[model samples]
Target: MNKSVFILPVIVILIAAILSSIFIVDEREKVLVLRFGRVVQTIDEPGLNFRIPLMDQVVTYDDRIISIDMAAQEVIPSDDRRLIVDAFARYRIVNLERIRQATGAGGDQAIAIADQRLENILNAETRTVLGEVTSGDILSTDRDALMLRIRNAAIAEASALGIEVIDVRLKRTDLPSQNLERTFERMVSERQREAEDERARGREAATRITALADRTVVELESDASREAQIVQGEADASRNAVFAQAYGQDTEFFEFYRSLEAYREGLATGNARLVMTPPEDFFDYLRSPNGNVAE
Candidate 1:
């Protein structure tokens, strides 16, 4: 019975010893030991750690980088243009003691507090800084400089919360819905006007070229027609002069030949007629010497 009693107490003591000195620190976490609600020691390296179990409590906090996405906010620029800005930030705990003091222990509540604080700082800083810049400036070649400025401002503000802001980036920056529509409409109208101007210029050039070509063709045709008419007039005058010379060379023979041609043309109707005339004229050739008509 005494042996049993000793074994029971020994087992109980062993169990108590096991429970008292055991602590665990994860690879991605840091543990802080609090004795009677007062910080006694902090364990930064990951592995097994020891502390008086009943008298001390170990609180673990994540040391890895965390991301917080802020909601899209409407901001008015210096030019009074409304824009929707979406942003996010990356942060990590730098000072565990300060974090513990500020946010009693680490969990969703601590993260929430940190997130809210960061967001507030970001919002105020962004509004103040960005409000002084126009929309064009924000989206211009200076955008990188602006982003750097925003990151610096956010880091400066978040430093007080024991959180190190690694980066602050804007996910998107856009004009409001109505402003977008107006901008698109203006761009479309401008493009249309430019196209119309180009078309008009092209048409004018084509018309000028066509008119010049038509004038050139008309001039060539008129010149050719005039040349042809001049040649024809010369040809007709030459033929008439040649005929007049021939007729003047033998007047009597020409008259006789012309009379014969006239008689033949008149007799083609198959009718004959006689007329009295003196034989002394050229018609006497077809008459007898007695002044009577021969055949």
Candidate 2:
């Protein structure tokens, strides 16, 4: 009866020991076995694992991709322009053994340490790479290329911490408020200068147009005066020709008509002086239809 009781306790103790020695690894976990606080084995696959109980320590880490939200950092480009950069990253532990060896801290503690180191690397590399480009590059599609450079640089640095940087992305980029105000002021000044130049050009063109119009007016007035003189000469010539024709057709009637015209012009006023009459001049034409000399 004492042997049966002792065997039952022994069997229970063996079962407990076996259960303690054996460990389960989930597919989502990476099991790291440490011996005397030193890494001995790294198991990434999901299955049963064996370890020395009480002497062996096991630590699990997420084998899946992890994301890091990088805080906003200021960077200065080659153009001496300052910018605020907000970025994020995708990373994973590519070497669990190396990670445990370096930190000896597992789980959330390891992740936190790695995150702090990666953030430093990310910020430094971001500053180094972006500092080689211009501020315009940050605000443009060229930032995609710049980010690729930062990712490559970050991956190189993060390898030291057993973290593989998968990708780096920029969430936002902007100039400082003071820079924005300065840029706006400069743009306004440029526009104002351009406006002034345009107005000056317009004024110059208007002056030229007005001068051309004045010249045209002077030319037109001179042309009209010349044409008026020509018409008056032509009319006078026509009237003299008519008079000559009438004189040639009938000499007596021409003389009589000419004398009557002279009398009417000379005697238009009541006080008109006429020293010659009758015998002295053909004055008889005033009373006779046909001009004749007074006896």
Candidate 3:
């Protein structure tokens, strides 16, 4: 019984000793071994790792990229316009030794320190770069280029703290309430003026077209009137020519005929009175029984 008790205690002690010496370093984690509170070696691979049990210590750090969402900061533009700017950054640990030296050990404190550093860098750099641009530039076409420049500057600034900034993005950019309302009003007025100008131009065009149409109508009517007058004058001249030709064919009859026509026209006029003697030449043609006047 005494021998078995001694053997069981020995086995238990050996197992405890093995468990204390052996430590696991996961694939996604990096372990730093410290001797006398000073970092001696860093184990970056997975599987079993041997340490000096109670004398040596292991410090683990996550090898994954971390995201930090910065709070909104009020920034001023070159035009003296105030805007709220919100941004975020993606960073990862690049140098484990530098991270340990800067943050000391691990946990929330290290993350807080790194975040503070990143925020300071972002604030300082953004202010300097963003201050050079006017409010219009911020709200217009150059915003993307400005963002890229700021991101690159921020990455460089944060690199010395063992924080490798993978990407930086601006989430929101807002003008002040007063500025927004004023801008909206101005835009509305501009659109209204443009619409009014378009309407005026349309009216002017319509008037011009109407006047041209009226002028054309008047010209056509005048041309038709002139053509009608010319046709009537031609028809009258043709009738007169036909009568003249018929009269020229018989001279004596034409003279007798013209004398009778003249007498009838003269008597038909109410302003004249006809009183003729019976033996007069003008009445001789009427009195003669053979229808011939004496010489």
User: Per-residue alpha-carbon lDDT of model 3 for 148-211, expressed as tens digits?
Assistant: 7787898766777777888777788898777899978999999999999999999999999999
lDDT of each: 0.82, 0.88, 0.82
TM-score of 1: 0.67
Deviation from native of the Cα of residue 227 in model 3, angstroms: 3.0
Give the per-residue lDDT digits (tens) of candidate 2, residues 1-295. Answer: 9899899999999899899999999988898898888778889899999999898998999888999999999999999989999999999998988787667788989998888889889999999998998888888965678889999988777887887999999999988877899988999999999999999999999999999999999999999999998999999999999999999998888887888788788889787677765555545665555346443
Clashing pairs in 1: none
Ten residues in a row with the worst lDDT in model 2? 286-295
Model 2's lDDT to the true fold? 0.88
lDDT of 1 by residue, 223-266 (tens): 99999999999999998897688789977666666767766775
lDDT of 3: 0.82
Please list the Cα RMSD from the true structure of every candidate, rounded to 1 decimal place.
6.9, 5.0, 6.3
- Worst lDDT window (10 residues) for model 3? 285-294
The C-alpha TM-scores of every prediction are 0.67, 0.74, 0.71
